[model samples]
Target: MPRQPASFLPIADALRTRIRAGDWPVGERLPSRAHLAAEYDVSPMTMQRAVERLIIEGLLEGRAGSGTYVRTPRERLRMVRSRHRERRGGSPFRSDMAEQGKRGTWESHSQARVPAPDGIAHRLAIQPGDHCVRTAYEFLADGMPVQLSTSWEPMAITDGTPIVLPELGPLAGMGVVERMRTIGVVIDTAVEVPRPGRATQEEANMLGISVGDLLMRIERTYYDADGRPVETADITVPDVRWEIAYEIGIEQPE
Candidate 1:
């Protein structure tokens, strides 16, 4: 077979080099695809592919009727998970942001008596048909979305209690551990498991990020002293936007 046209890889590498060398400073528009293709000695489609790769990496952004330009780098924030903050005031996220010298806020929508789905049922250790309160939240720092969450709590634990609605009453915005206290439920332990994931279209919309971007998902469950699961939540953060950290003290052996 005859030699085929050069692939987009070499073109991408050349463009990447130019970007890093500051040949085109941030906010400077890249030449049109046809122009770039002629300059790089590649087909316009190949050149377009190279620019798209850069766009996904957040190195460049495209504007309608305008060319692509270098993107401004955003500073990634730190999200700390220090167990001690569970005892402090406000929500857990608020405490974390405070420690990072930022203001935190959240918006939540809750549905009462919603039937538990299979995934939520498993997390709460309850039957699929069990009644639960489902809450979806978007948490932000200084008006920029940083986290997204969906939580479910079995009504069997808080039904008919003043703390049924998580963001309501005098206990509003108080972390789960404290809100459960009003109903005589002594939450003794919590568990969290985090894994890598890709942002869904909805998640990306909520977090103001691109779809298919990396995300860190944390599955968390709160338990009463009796070892019964009381509530469960899925917390997701854009991987490029935050540095997740954990702190635990070691036990000294005698």
Candidate 2:
């Protein structure tokens, strides 16, 4: 015999059907969990579990000191990754947001002369324990947190340079490609590998999503013209709110 579904799952399915049937309109408050439990003839705990599932599905939203409400649908934005964007000579992130009529901004914190951990050293082609510059970034679209990144760069390349700190100095906020160029380093390529993951508690807090929500983690590395790794970063994006799109160039025959 086949195993039975969890008790709350059927309840959740019924609630989803009702919501879709317009029993509660968008932005309308849902009835109390106790009332819902009595109506379903289930314990309050089971009702809570059913409601929480819908919340995670983005069909409902909870308000502090208020009841859960039907969520207004939101449009998922696209983040395009392409070499053409790097050639545009400005902040690619800002350009992306502007295309969608939203403002793009980021807050970053940099720590210089930090020792590279084993994993970071491998990515940057440096020895473990070598000094490096580490920067943490929180990116926002229209003042709402949407992405996060942490970058590592070898200190030997930028220790005495003006672009040592990613978000400070005259060349601040110019992205890795431009900043390295200012210091006489020509960044020719960047490679990114994306993987699916579940959000941890800390990540959930930062992106304003529930723990265990789906996310995409990207490991990106930039290389100089000589093929030396110059910078490496781990970028995080919430999968539900954003779609990662890649633009590839087709080579032309000479």
The lDDT per prediction is: 0.87, 0.91
Give the candidate number with the greatest TM-score.
Answer: 2
Q: What is the C-alpha lDDT profile of model 2 across 1-254, one tens digit per residue? A: 99776688889889999998999999899999999999999999999989987886678999999999999655688889899888877677777788889998999999999999999999999999999999999999999988999999999999888988988999888889989999899999999999999899999889987677799999999999999999999999999899999999999999
Candidate no. 2 TM-score? 0.87
Residues 123-208 of candidate 1: C-alpha lDDT, one tens digit per residue: 89999989999999999888888899999999998999888999988898997998998789988888899999998889877887
**Candidate 1 off by > 4 Å:** 1-17, 26-29, 32-34, 37-72
Give the worst 10-residue stretch by lDDT in candidate 1: 3-12
TM-score against truth, every candidate = 0.81, 0.87
User: Model 1, residue 222: displacement in angstroms?
Assistant: 0.8
Residue-pair clash count for candidate 1? 0
